[model samples]
Target: MDFRAINTIVFAFLITMCSFGQINCNCSIGSYLEKIELLNTRDSLEVFELSAELKKTKLEVCKFKALEIEFNYFITQLNEEKAFAVLNELEDYLGRINCESDLKFNIYINKAKYFKLHNNYEKLSEFAFKALKEAEYLKDSNKEIEAIKQIVYLFTRMDEDDKNWQYIKRAEKLIFKQSNPIRSVKNFRWLAFEYETKYTRTKRKPLLDSLFIFANHSKKGAKKYNIFDELALSYRALEAYSYHKGNAKNALKYIDSAIFYAKKIKGKKNLSGLYISKAWDHLDWGEKELAVKWMDTSFAYDTKDDIAGFMMHHLDATDLYEQAGRLDKALSSYQIHSRIKDSIFNTERTQVINELETKYKTELKDAKIKRLNVLLVITLLIIVSILLAGSVIQLKRTRKKNKILKRAIEEQERLEKELSDVRGEIAQDFHDDLGNKLARISLLSSLISGEVSIKSPNIKSKIKQINEDANGLYKGTRDFIFSLKSNSDYLEEVVTYLSDFGGDIFNKTEIKFTVEKHISTNVKLPYYWSKQIVFIFKEALTNAMKHSNCHTVKLSFGYQGYQLSIRCEDDGIGILESDLQSLNGLSHMKTRGIKIGCELLINSNIGEGTAVILKGNLKEDII
Candidate 1:
């Protein structure tokens, strides 16, 4: 075997040993923190395994810490949905514990980081400002500076140069006021990086100058404290400043110096990140060969056992190698990267599904929901595969490309919410627009009946019919709107509405209208069922008033076993049995009844009365 293969096996074995050591760690908050910290040390994919163990822990505090670590993991991985999940749990746990201000401050900071990652500036601002206040209350300069840095980071990401510089300068002044300024070494380097980022964005000369000052200040702190990481990062900033200033020789000098310090610590692990970043910069600069060299160097240092770090560098290195026309190496790197990517994607998918299933099962107790969870997982998998696509062949992580696999689920939720809102809006608009016009038509007919005098008797009779027709339409529209808005599941509500309509149609006439309910239990009716049932009964009542010549009409609601029954009966000079089916109103009621899975029956005699009864299986409709 080649040396690299031997090295890989050794690294894997050592990590397995460390992980096994950590796995049986005593159940405590400290153990949870240490295990989660392995995310930084061992591998990013270790987060999934460690989080699984943390979930099974009985300690809420450990769970809270695990979620915090997972939040950072997801944020770095650009998995916004999982990040959102961790943030939600962490927030919930925070409230349950009623943690002190220091802990609350950290949680707020975590929240701010999450919103920043998701590009939710509105929420980022809220939490970032909250952290600032907490820092002030705690009177911790480091915390205060950290909060300010976060706010500055937000504005920087948003490309708000004015706001970014304002916060950066404010943090700068505060850090300088401190006695040692050594505690703020990393803070200075962060400010330097921000300046470097701003300079890149705007290409402003002043930003370039400010970055040099901060880099120098960071270097001073690093030299004073012998903080090798900060020392190397300071030189990296200086290198960037020099390179941007068109001093390539000086830039190379600073980079070599940075590497010198970088190699002095951490087995060049940090150097791998620096190399990959610069490799990307060089690749963007069109120096493909140099980019390839640096990418390979970074990959060499990246631990093969650190699955996420390996995949990250390999993915980027694939792009670099591809651009350099090293097709064989690119293909090899891409294969490994794709395999790891697919593994992580599948793991995250199962985790999200499990979380959703647990949440839904807790909130909704139904076998149907369990069935729906299966569909959810299948749908999620399909969407992730579709969106992911052959871009895995390229394997570069762009912001647009890194929108997170759970985007499909979030987008589905958003669309569902939008659809419900539109339904409500359309229903309201339908009611308002048609209801007003119908009411106007009825008012006009009433005015024409009382105020206008028609000389011909036939014309006057026609006018009375028009007025009654207009009133019937106006009342029908009102009932339809009521049914549309009602959320009641019981059939009794619809029966009451029909009875009220019967009273309205028979008003001022010599007809008595009675409504009776013999329901032993609530028979559930769907939303569409309510509108259909009401309209069917309305047609029966209108027919009884206009044609049945009924002196008394009764509407009854009843339920038996699993069946629903409704009757509209009238005592009038009834129709012939042959004419019962031939009645004009009977057809419309039957059509509406068919929609609700009901059979409409018409019973009439020449001298007795007519009864329109409806029967249907309530169980089927409910299902």
Candidate 2:
């Protein structure tokens, strides 16, 4: 075949395939829609059959867009009275896929209505709140209104009048802005119910007035099918208010109006409530037989499963039978009353127990979590304590080692100082007494050798040489002893020694020296301590002379009150920054100053001259 003919055939084949696929897709979607329609119409058996078929078809299609359309249809089906079918479908759909916001909201609304019909008030209230939140997110006003109405109804049934009033007000505000007569009338009716119920519970007159106003508003231009029950309830509330106010005639008149409106409604079940109201009025007026007759008629008319009204009727019958002295009838009625009362009490107790169980489980869970946290903290503390104890033991061992090393160093320093002092004393003894005696002996030997020189001229020359060498040795020893004994003095003597020493040093450097003495004989040891401090000053000045390349130095000593101060200054190149960390010369000087109970301050900078200050508090012995 040619290329053009082949292309034409391929195009036609593709179109046919596309058409077949569209037909199959539409058929699958149609099947899902038909199943939802049956469910919405309350055909539960057919819904179950169709739902199974749809599930198979969905697997065959396996498309998300098709699934979404199916979900939307399921949401529509959920709005109907056959809610079990819808809930089953919803559980499947929610399990399979996520629904759109509008679809989810519709599902919640349907679930809330279904729960209300089942008399599951707690679930009804919970779903109503859920629907309200979804409706708010979708911004759907009708859904919002419906959800609010359901919430108000649930709250009223549960006897939560405060919450009932709050939702009722919200629904009323929404209804006021809508032009729909049916919705507006419904809102007004609910508002009237809220006010009447509040009045019944609180016996407040203002609530009765509010109920009448809303009832009248609801009946305005409304069809007969609407507003009848609300109008009757409003009249009954007014009658109750009148009864409370002691206006018996007005109360009877309003009760008659209540019966009239209630009878106008087509249903006998609806009319039973009016009969009960009339029986209450008769019983209040002390007509016991008439009240019993009305109550029996009311019971005959009550066809629906109104448990509260049924219980109340039996209770009233028992009361009336007792008052009439019919003991047998009274016993039978009382038995029925007791049965219903027990049922209600048991139901309330079950609800309370369920709530308490839930609370207990929650508390148990919180207690477990708290216990775990406490255990974790305690474990951490124990671990930390062990680690801290090890660290403390190690630190103590390190401190003990450091103390032993420090004591050894101090003992070595003490031994070295003692050895230095002993060597100085031995050198002084050789110089002072032994050297002088050796010098005298050498002179006497020289004289004896001279007298015998005529006999031995050679011996005379040798003797003269020996005498000169002995004299030189004697002079060296005398200078050594004099240096050792130079600083040994009492207070007054030490002060005199420092003045002479400082004057001699200043003369050598051509610097000035000034001494101010406060030497009391009582200050002997203090003055002796200052003499050692003078050695520190001498070392600092000698350092300045060697390194400072300047000519002038000044030394000053003074005492004021209890303090003695010595200052030595030099106008020379000061200490270098690099030499400040050295521990040899300046450190020794500072140690000497500290030994004498002095605080030594060295003020020096590069090229700024040096000043050494020694200050100490004089002892009381000196004072």
Candidate 3:
């Protein structure tokens, strides 16, 4: 069959397996592939339906296997572009899908096959090594054997015999640990091809014997596994070996066997190679016409888009044509072969240039992106710096304003303290100097009154009254000094001073003065409030001592909640209610309490004593 018909069959078989394999019968992948291989190839419409149905399956493993099969189908069809596109899809899915080691092994093996078809030996070697590692990780001896075989094939193609033999031995070690007939057949065939090539180059008999032995070993496994492709390859290796030995009869026999088996498979990819071997046989046998015919047939079968294969076909044609004395055809074939060689060389050069251009463009784009990132960072930093600077400047201005206000408050406090000190000093001087002078004047008047009482009775009486006035003046001046000298900010100080003043005033009198204090020491009284309280107490005391004829006087200071109270009462001859207006001292006390925000009350009866009560809200006074 032709290449197109073979590819269509392979493509159809893959699609059928991918779509109906597990869906219709719940069959395993191996069973599905076997079933499809037995059926006739389907058409393109069936292939499309299969692809659509495969996409509908929810299983990631199924989708992944379908993609792999599609990739292989394209490879068999000699569709490198579509195969590479499928490979890209596989790689992209690999990152997204979490697959098992067996799946990874298959993915790498497929990639290796892709590079092998494209003749990219380096990449082929790379993926082969990767697949080998995945196989080892999976502990699948069969996959490992296949990967090692691919490595062997690549090394042999590159003419590195040492590397090729090293991998062959590695595959051999793995093959003994496993039982995969197909893989064993593949390994043996590779070994046979290796020995046959070596024998042809060195013309060694020992190498020829080794080649025949490996070829026969491969044939044994191929027949057991029904692997016709490897079997055909083994026959080709034997044909080359026999041809090198100058055994034309044996070589022709082997070539016919290679062709017979190769014809069983479609596309005739191996058949083309076998035809070349037959043409070589005809040349050796000196049948120039038959040689040309075989060469033409080989060229017709070389349908794959491989520049190296076409070049080899033309080169062989040129030699055959020259030997046949077809000078025109010989020169034409040589020229075509040379042109194809140049095209291959130029194609490689263009690829290199494209890679360099792509690399340069990528680097330039990266540099621009880096530069833009730096600019963005710098802009952000500059904006942040400006904001910080503005904050610092505003903070400094606020601190400066606070400093100015603090200094103003301190200076005001200093001046008020100085004024208070000056007032206290003046009060002290008034009490010490003026109060003492008035006391001395009163003593002198009393002495004069006593000395002239009998000789000048009128003069003694007037002098006695003057002495009483001077005494009253001294007491008033002392009271004034006491009130003025101390601040009333401390409730304890004010109450204590008032109690002391009452004690001193009635010390020589018959009236007993009792000071009852129940106020907390922490209570604060305003200055004006304290002075008015002291004045009211003094007035009540003086009125009692001079006119009430009381035996005891009680003075009390108390506080509850935020209210302060001062009380003074005496058990004396109580004044009449009509006489209250006549008392100027009582009136003055009332006026002072009003000015200091205190409530003043006077209670008196004809037989009971008089009581003066003062109540003040200390909190109201402070406010």
Candidate 4:
């Protein structure tokens, strides 16, 4: 027998032995698959026999895998008839015998590839979606990524850019979830090609950059896996990027590199495609003779079945010939182009026939599956009814609990308001009654001190001490009343109070106080949050007033989107970073921010100044 036959027989023998031997059957199966993949189109008979031998295996999964390998072999050889026949066989196998979801998934992907290769867009779209659904059901991210990529390409070919972008977005999401290096490389290369095509059409700088990025990533992955084909494609992408950037020298440099790599690989198709690309660049730059030279060189490289590339070359030749005033040659080239276009039309018609046959078969299979699905649906409905009854009872309990929770929340809010009112009343009592009384005491003591100074020095000293104590008590009461006041929670009210308080406190001092409000005056906050925020602000201000020996203390407020931001900055000899660890007031400000669900930032330098920022999400906290 021939070498291929001998090789196939040996591999099959090894697999059979391993199946009954002590070695792992899966390892032997993989070896068998490796051998099959190693065979080219010339080894068709051997491939066919080896593929048929898969049915001898006891494992159903292996049978499914064998069918996939057989189908792939036919596809790679461009034997569409055999490929579809094998696909139909696989479908029949699935109908009669039980197979794993993975097997079924592979069958769907194979059918998708068949349709895609034949340019049956409608069938390809349907199969791609089916594959995606299966992949998602199996939680197979790699498979899902492949399906999404195919769908993206299909939509792009259909000129449905919006739909293509949606699939691109989906592929991006799925790619990150897959951790396989080779698969990642493949996905990135697909993305690179997609963007590269778009760049070629639009000549958009951003799209070119995107292509370069993904292409670079693909190169890295390919180098890691020793995949020369992908490496060559990456180089071609770089060439495209450079050419589009108006750098002919650099573009030619990359194309040379790509050609060198492509020569090392088995596929002359890629090599010829590169030559076509180089020719087109020369043609675009008005180098007609150089373009013709490269076109002849491309023809020398056996570009098997590269119809698109052939079309491009023919069209370019026609243009050049017409420009040279060679009417006969130009007419001949145009006629050849017309013939190629007719062939494409014929191919499209064949694909339509294939699509109809596949659809009819699918419908017949679905009719059978639908019967089984109806029984499953009935069983599911019974389970769902039981679940629904339970859900209703549980939902009622949840509703009851929600009602109780709401009532408790309302009651709590009411009590909080009442408590705030009571605190306000007490503050009013302290400010109006106790503060006035203390002031009166201070005045009376001063008068007594003046009257007794002539009679007794001891009485005069005692009256003077009483006056100083009353003055201290009055000041303390005023500060306490200010803290207890509820109006501080309102945005406008707090800002006005801060301005007046700062003006009064710093009036006699050299320091200046500034309050700048960037937010609306009508912006209101929850009572608890506003209270905490104000308390934090007061602490920061107090620290600045007591310690920062500066000219200005500025307070600013801003609201953007859902966030409310407040800043307290002082122009002063700021606190040391090391000293900040021990600052009690700063710690209190941070704690209050945490309690209010805000982010607090404190920035300080020894000589620059200090800034305190408190930011919170108003959308979440306001309610």
> Scored by CA lDDT, what does every candidate get?
0.72, 0.63, 0.74, 0.72
Top candidate (TM-score): 4
Q: Which ranges in model 3 have alpha carbons more than 4 Å from their true place?
A: 1-63, 95-97, 100-102, 120-122, 136-141, 148-162, 172-178, 267-270, 315-623
Q: Write down the TM-score for model 2.
A: 0.37
Q: Write down the TM-score for model 1.
A: 0.35
Query: Which one is best on lDDT?
Result: 3
Per-model TM against the reference: 0.35, 0.37, 0.44, 0.46
Q: For residue 477, what is the lDDT in candidate 3?
A: 79
- Look at candidate 1 and tell me the lDDT of residue 424: 64
Q: Write the per-residue lDDT of candidate 3 for residues 1-623, one digit (tens) a residue.
A: 66566456555655765765444322244444443232112233333444455556665655665676667667766678988999989877766655443367877898888887786655676678778767765677878787887777665544566666666767767755655455566777777776776665667788788778878888887777666777788889889878888988899999999888877654325356788889889888888788778877887788747656677677877887888767787899899988876754455644553354345346556756886886685555556655878899999999999999999999989997997898799997997799889989998998777778497888988898999999888877766776676465567877787788788879989889998988665576676666677777777877878899999999988888887888989988898898888878888999998998889999999879999999888665453
Which residue pairs in candidate 1 collide?
Answer: none
Candidate 4 lDDT tens digits, 52-139: 6776777665676577677876766566788899899888876554444446777778889888766566677677877877776677
- Runs of candidate 2 with Cα error greater than 4 angstroms are 1-100, 103-106, 139-145, 152-178, 223-269, 308-623
- Measured on C-alpha atoms, candidate 1 has an lDDT of 0.72
**Model 2: per-residue Cα lDDT over 1-623, one tens digit each:** 66566456555655765765553323335545433422322233443455456556644332433333344344333333434664655656554543333267666776776665555555665677778766765666767888888777655544556757777777767777776565566667667766766776888787777776776666563434444555566576667656656676777788888877767543222467667667667777777777777867777777545454466677767776677556777789789878865765456644753464355446556766886886685555556655778899989998999999999999988995886587578867786578878788797977878687487888888888788888867754543443344233234544565566667656766555566655334243443464466568667666766677767776666666667767778778888767766848888888878887789888889888888888888767544
- Ranking of models by lDDT: 3, 4, 1, 2
